[model samples]
Target: MLKRFFPDLYVDSIYHIPYETLKKNQIKGLVFDIDNTLVPFDVATGDQRLVTHFKELTRLGFQICLVSNNSEERVTIFNQDLQVEAIHKAQKPLRRSFKKAMKLLKTNPKTTAIIGDQVFTDVWGGNRIGMTTVLVRPVVDRDEWITKIKRGLEKKILKVYLKNSNNQ
Candidate 1:
């Protein structure tokens, strides 16, 4: 189905997300993809700005979790600042990790959102479980070769998605 790869919302960056609006919608938890979604792939920790934002989200009653397909060493180090529940080698676009993320936050699908920069992994997995999905632009272009290939496919899907949205 078209929803499988289509994000519920698109934004320039995670920093620009309207958390208040999400709260208004009764979204209680968020599962985020670490690399590119929160920061670039090479970054090891959340900067003060990002850490503060995460803290504010927590203050607003949103449980957050970091789910990544990267190694534990990478995800572990990157999560040191935010210090929320985290899972590594998530194997996203698969329902298992998404389910685990929901369990981590102790939230149901309707009240949880999955945020990431990739459609195939993040959006697809979220949609599969009927959870809201948010797509943000990648922080940088230096992705692994596998991801780079998926990005190519994502561009084509985006074109189709745009055409459909315009028609609607």
Candidate 2:
């Protein structure tokens, strides 16, 4: 059903997430999709703003890992300064990488959360594994070709999800 793609939380940006609330909820680990979730697709590295944000999350006592379908070089270059655990070419919406990330964080699904910009990938994948899923609006309107195609379908689902949420 459409619920498979639905996120447990949706926000405008990662900066808008309530880390303290998540901590209180016992969510101790986070798996993040790097490209559009953290930076624009074209951006090659984490900006100072994002680095500081990760530091804050760590200080707040959360384990963090970056999971991306992008190439290893891409993930590596972006992760250089941040220096956290990372999984590249993640092939998300699949249980394997999500499980691997959980292993890396040493946390189970109940204590883990996944944050990303895509519904089919991040949300569906996280929900499948019983991890809290947080969907954030893409960092920029622009997207890679494949993502652009997926976004069209995502728009329809999001419209229905938003409508249903409001009616509640």
Candidate 3:
């Protein structure tokens, strides 16, 4: 159903997330999608800004994990400097990797949230597991071909979701 794709929160980008509010709500762990969620597809590493942001989150006592469908090489290269728990080739929208992430964070669904750009993969997967899902706008317009196809469908779903949300 369309409700499955509807994120608990939708914002412009990761930078727009209400981290303090999440903290206040007792969200102790965060699972993030890397490419196009935290950085553009072409970006190989987290920028200094992102690094600092991660540090801030850690200082606030939040456990973090990066989950990506991309190859291990890609995820490894990206996480080399950041050093947070990471899962590559995640095949998301499937519950397995998400469970694994929660295990690594030592957090349960009630205190964990997933942040990503894709509604089908990130939002739906997290929602299925009872984790708060935060959908952020893609970091860039360009996307891998398969994701490009999904994006078109996501737009339609978002239209209905937005209408329903506004009416509420």
Indicate the worst ten consecutive residues by lDDT in candidate 3: 1-10
The lowest-lDDT stretch of 10 consecutive residues in candidate 2 is 16-25
RMSD (CA, Å), candidate 2 to true, equals 0.6
- Write model 2 residue lDDT over 1-168, tens digit each, in one string: 899999988999999998888899999999999979999999999789999999989998999999999999999999998999999989999999999999999999999999999999999999999999999999999999999899989999999889988999
Model 3 agreement with the true structure over 81-120: per-residue lDDT tens digits: 7899999999999999999999999999999999999988
lDDT at position 152, candidate 1:
85
lDDT to native, each model: 0.90, 0.94, 0.94
Q: How far is candidate 1 from the true structure (C-alpha RMSD, Å)?
A: 1.2
Q: Which scores greater on TM-score, model 1 or model 3?
A: 3
lDDT of 1 by residue, 1-168 (tens): 665799888899998888889889989999999988898888788789999999989999999999899999999999887899999999998889888988989998999999999999999989999898999999898898889889888998988887887798
| Local error of candidate 3 at residue 7 (angstroms) | 0.2
Error of 3 at 37 (Å): 0.5
Q: Which stretches of candidate 2 lie over 4 Å from their true place?
A: none
Cα TM-score of candidate 1: 0.95
